[model samples]
Target: MIPLSPEILAALALALLAGLVAGAWPARRRLLAQAAEAARQAERAAQLQDRVAQLERDLSAQADALESWRARAQDGRLELAQLQAAHHEKLAAFEELRQAFDQSRATLRAEFQHLAGQVLEEKSQGFSRSSQDALGSLLRPFREQIESFQRRVNEIHDASVSGQARLDTEIRRVLETGLKMSDEAQSLAMALKGDKKATGNWGEVLLERSLQLAGLIAGDHYQAQASFRDEAGNRRQPDFIVRLPDGKHLIIDSKVSLVDYDRAVSAATPEAREAALVAHVRAVRQHIDDLARKDYSSLTGMKSPGFVLMYLPIEPAYIEAMRRDRELFDHGYRHNVVLVSHTTLMPVLRTVATLWMLARSNEQARALGDQAGGLYRQVEMVAARLQKLGHALGAAAAHYNGTVTAVAGQRGLYGKVGRFAELSAKAGRPLPALEPLLADFEVQRLDGIAPGADHVPETGRADAGSPPGAVPEDLHPPGEPNP
Candidate 1:
């Protein structure tokens, strides 16, 4: 409120200006900082907007890719379904084929069993009746073997029949196990490829199996490894000795070498096969020569034919030998040796058995003829005795009629006996009443043979109570009518 001079006011203004300037400087610094902060916020907001736009574009692209994946999945499902249906069709077709195969197999098996059973039954029935006598002992060893063979054959046939379900399962399993069998076969072939002893043993086993299949009973119909001594005192044994129906023997040799033949089969090249086949043929010829040199036919108890059977257990080996050398079989034949395979020897063994059966049948027939002759002689003696009995009976009937006529004829002992009955009553003791015999009553002759004149009247009369021409019931012989 006090009035001041101008000079004092001017000095105060200068000081106040200085103070305002200091305060304004701080405010300006604050405004400049606020403006810089606002510019940074706007730039950050622009960057955020650009980021949102990029994210939306990315989201849209992902949604389109997702739709494409959904469509591709739908097409894949359709394709998979089609493939599955095709697989099912093929499976159904295969199943039908397998079922048909099983049905056919079953039908064939049933038919085979029926036919074989009929043949076996007929043969067994014939053999049974024929074996009841002396032949029984001869065939005893064979019966059990034949029955066992038949049972094994039946079991094999039964085992061969497989159901459809089993067939399916086996089909699936065979895929896994089939290669294993092939591997085993290869291993076996390798084992026997170069080994001579093992091959020979296998051949011998095959020969024995063939013998069994041919229904030859060992030790009965055939002897295995029967020993014989030559004139030089050397013991020789044949693989098998078949007993012929004529009491002779058949020698079979199973020691044929097949090493070269196995090599021929496994040969890779045609030239190698040719070389191996030539060696096989040479080996076969050598074996034939060896058999012929042994001369089993001349052995003491062999009784074999001029020819000895050289058994080649493998059919292919025999065929290969013959094919390579056309004259191989002829060569063997010339040397008194015959080359035979399993197929050929089976028929020979069967023929020997047939011959034995026929020989036994002839013996049984001869015995039957002798029995028939004896039966006829016995019948003749019985007829003579029956004739003599008839004659004696006729004579007895005549004697009986004569005694009856003497005792009970008119004015005979019966009338006298009737008078004695009254005397017996007067004596207080009744006599036994004697019945009278009729004059027409007579005994009939046996078999309608005419009786003696004293027994029967010249004119024929009916026998006591019998009709004319009727014989007594007890007098008729079996199966014969009365005359």
Candidate 2:
């Protein structure tokens, strides 16, 4: 509002010019900085573009490689599938071939076994027949027993071969039957739970069957329900009395009750079963005690072992009893009682049968021994007679030889008989030619004769032409011609 002089105005103009120059310098510096920043941004953008192009190229190459691998993988998969199919077919063929081989092998084995059995049987029969024939005259005393023994041997051999062949089948059948029987037995046990007499009868039947299976005859090898009277006149009847080769007895009694065992079998719970088992064991123990009191070993006229056999009809009952009471066997043994099931008793019966066979064999051998001794004595008598006959024959031969030497010597009857033949030339038989033996002739003597025993000196001369060593004419047979 109060502008005064030109100098003041000039000063204001210089200040304004300096301010505009400062502003223009700042603007130029800002513009140059902005241009450098824009250049760096563009360079950065170019580097980014180059990296994107390289990444695109790499992606395309990888796609081509992946396609090549995929094609090879497809071919490999096809080849693998074909190989698997061939392997499976070959494996199936091998299985069929193996099965056929097994069938052929089995057929061959059966045929071989059959042929072998037949051959063995034929040979055995032939040998037995021949032995019977050879020994028939010599073994007159044992003929019947020998025949019986031979028949038994044949029966045993046949049974053995048949049993061996059927053993596998029998074992399988037994296992299957045992399983089935176990179920049936459980049911039977339930039915007979309260019937004491029925259970005893059942046990006795099984015991008899076992004896029969072991080749024991009822009247011979064993007796059923054999009654013996004790000292007190008590009629003690044992279910079976098995006879041994040594004339001893095996007493088997079938009196065990299976009622508690049946209860155990039908128990509804673990605790119930446990209780029933305990009761069953106690019942078995009680039965053992009762059987032990029978004292079958002390029966009159019977040679029995100390222990009596207590037979159980069911195998499972025996097994369960023993399983529950591990010391049950020792317990029964201490009480002179033996617990036996069918399976266990079979071996004892078989052993008894074997013993009987061995005893029969020993008896046959003893008879043979006695016969052999008699035969040896007969041979000695025959040999002595043969020696005496040889001595007589040797003496007769020496006498005949001496008489022949006397006649056939240079001074024998032939020399004088030649003149007689000339004298009787007209006789019908032209005098049978009498050729003397060679002067160096030899006479064979009996091998066993003593040196001088068979020699005989000529007693007297038959004719004047006879030699001094000639035997007497009376010693020669009347009908015999001169030597």
Candidate 3:
């Protein structure tokens, strides 16, 4: 037991209080550390949950991609099956056609052999030694004629080279201007982004001229420079709406892609060329995207299908760029844009016009054939009537000749040439009467038709049917009257 003095009791109680306080402080600190550890564990649990959620999301995306791949594989298998079936059907049909062709060929061969045998047997007697010699003589002369014809053909070919070159130069000159203007038209379209009357008029004129150069008329063949509204209420005006011969419309967006090409051509170094080429490729890709978004799918009134005809106003360089970098062009086709070069468009336009012309020509030929049939009938009737006409003509000619001779002997027409003719007769047998007619009859050189073509346009009658400004003296025979 402890002493119970006032001071010592107080001291002992104080010491006990100190010891208790110290123990309680250690217990409180341990409890606080445990609470902090629990908080750390809770945070780690939250992080693990987040990581699990992320992995699940990744797994879902992969599954979706796998499902898409399976769908594509199924579609491919179906296409392959259909292709195999079509191929088998085509092969069977081809075999049937082959059999039919064989039968027809055999029949033709049999008929030919039968005919040949019959002709050989029946004509065997007629084709004796004398006849064979005559045939040889005739064939020899025919070979000479064929040689002459071939020589004339060669001369004609040699003469035509100049004309072909001239025509090519003329055509290229005319078309080059249009190509230059097409470039300007592209510039004009870009300039049209700014609101201006000049831009508007320029756009219209550019489109109109392009249509005309493409051998089209606006009212008849196309509708030029039509405007459409975008979602932003801004007006979009395309350059050309080429109406094909079948009255179908193709929207043409002319883009100028030659700037980068020009730079590349003028580049002073390989590095420069490479830079310019890369820039040009990007520009072309951008152009494809721009031309693709021309509301072609919606405006053309087709969904999931549309043709965007991009008109590059340059030469084959633009087309070559696409060929060199196929990825850029693929960007275009992904959007259903077809990049058309000047050469391709020119032939396409020409073909379209030629087809139209052919259609008209066919119609004209049918009509002309009908008219020609009627003309043939009329000509046959005229041939009968011409017999009577010939009799009258002969009578009139004789009368005229007699009258001319009498009048000439009256010392009026023959007085001028009488002295000269009498002197010529004393010179050489009176210089035959036909010599004067032969001197005036000029055989026109058909130089315009290359060669081998005696296209003597109306040269038979020297007096009535000679070319303009032909010689007048002795155009008719000396016995024939000019009247």
Candidate 4:
């Protein structure tokens, strides 16, 4: 309850002052530190705001660039689609062209073959007619000679029939003339018999006449006096070497021995005639043996058959030889010698001529086939060129379509340009209009290409009236007369 001492009061005032001073200093320091922290925080907030603004601008620029890229991508897609469509169209056109070319080649080949066959047939017919005319001319003289001989015989017979004395003298004169003619004939026969060259020539003339009637030519179907060398280097000449279409040669030899035949006919007695006939048979057998020994089949450069032909010039002589010795024919066959007369030889020669004609026809056909092969090769070359052209066209179309698709697709060049303009406008900076891209192109289709329109004429169609697979009548040769 007592009043405070003066020293205590003074001490308390000082302590109070000290405490107030100390408290003020701490508050002021705390307030200054808070102020400094607030200043640093405000500076950091300002920097963060600036950084956020920069990020916003960068994000906006990135968005614009992305839009532009997207537009370019759309353009690429559009170009690709267009290219695909163009490629498809080009491929279709190429296929059509190839088909047309093939059809045209085939049609041309058929026409060529048909024309060739017609031409060959015409030539064959003309040749045949000419040959027949020549053969007829050759036989006319022989026919006239026979008619004259018959008329002479009839006149002689008429003279003999008259019974008056004057007519008897006329008959005797006719008889003497007949005897002179007979003697002349005997002399000619004897000359032919004596001269080997004349005998061979006579036989050859007969053979030639027979062959002509048989439609065979000397050099074309048969060679006269054709010489060949044997394996032993011995050269021999055959009277006639008949050529076969199958590359075979028929050797023919004509040797007529009329001496024995004339002796037999003019023999004084039956025993002499028999001996003469026997001698004639022996001569014929010897000739056959000689022909066999020639071995014509072994001749070089000649495809001679195993048998040789023993041609008898006269039909009467052939008959007499056969009748006198029946075994002569068999012996000739055994010796590989076939005895043939003018009548028999005609048939053989005609066969050979027919074979030659057939061979000629075959050769013509082979030539035609070769021509066709050449034509086919040419067609193939043309086709290859067409194929290459088509391939190039198809590739071009594909590239063009791709370009169109790229230009028209979303995010393509046009799209990117539009987007950029829009972005510029939004930013209050409009861009100028870009140049317009090319409009989509429409490919035109190929037309007017058809098969066989280039080489073959349109009028070359087969006859409507003709039956299926019917050949033209001109393809066949004219009918020839039978030998």
Per-residue lDDT tens digits for candidate 3, residues 40-143, read: 99999998997797679657755754564355446534543553464355334434333333343344335434433443354234456785475446335434
Candidate 2 C-alpha error for residue 187, in Å: 3.4
Could you give candidate 4's per-residue lDDT for residues 1-483 as a string of tens digits? 999999999999999999999889989999999999999999999989977976796577557545643554465345435534543453343333223323443444354344324423432234466754664464344345334433533443343233123322432343234224334444555566456667667667766666665567778778887777877778888888888988788888876565676676677865787788688778778888888888777777878768898987654456567766778889988888999875456446645654664465345334333433333333333333333434454565566656755665565565666567655646565434433333222111111121222532122222235322122222212341111
The candidate that achieves the highest lDDT relative to the unseen native structure: 2
The stretch of ten residues in a row with the least summed lDDT in candidate 3 is 434-443
Q: What is the C-alpha lDDT of each candidate?
A: 0.58, 0.60, 0.50, 0.56
Q: Each model's TM-score? A: 0.47, 0.52, 0.34, 0.46
Off by over 4 Å in 4: 1-196, 228-235, 262-278, 417-483
Model 2 alpha-carbon drift over 4 Å, by segment: 1-184, 361-394, 416-483
Query: What tens-digit string does per-residue lDDT give for candidate 2 at 1-483?
Result: 896799998999999999999889989999999999999999999988977875796577457545643554464345435534643553344343333333433443354344334433432343455644653453343334334433543444454445434433433343234335445555677888669999888778767866775668899999999888988998999889999887889989887888888887788865677788799899999988888777889988989887899987776677778777989999999999999865556546655765675465455444433433333233233233334544454465567667765666578766666677667757556534434222221112212111232332222212335432122232223343222
Question: Could you arrange the candidates by lDDT from highest to lowest?
Answer: 2, 1, 4, 3
Q: What is the lDDT of candidate 1?
A: 0.58
TM-score of 1: 0.47
For residue 50, model 2's alpha carbon misses the true position, in angstroms, by 81
Tens digit of per-residue lDDT, candidate 1, span 190-306? 468677777667666766766665556788788887888999998888888888878888888888877777787688865686788799899999999888888889998668777
Clashing pairs in 1: none
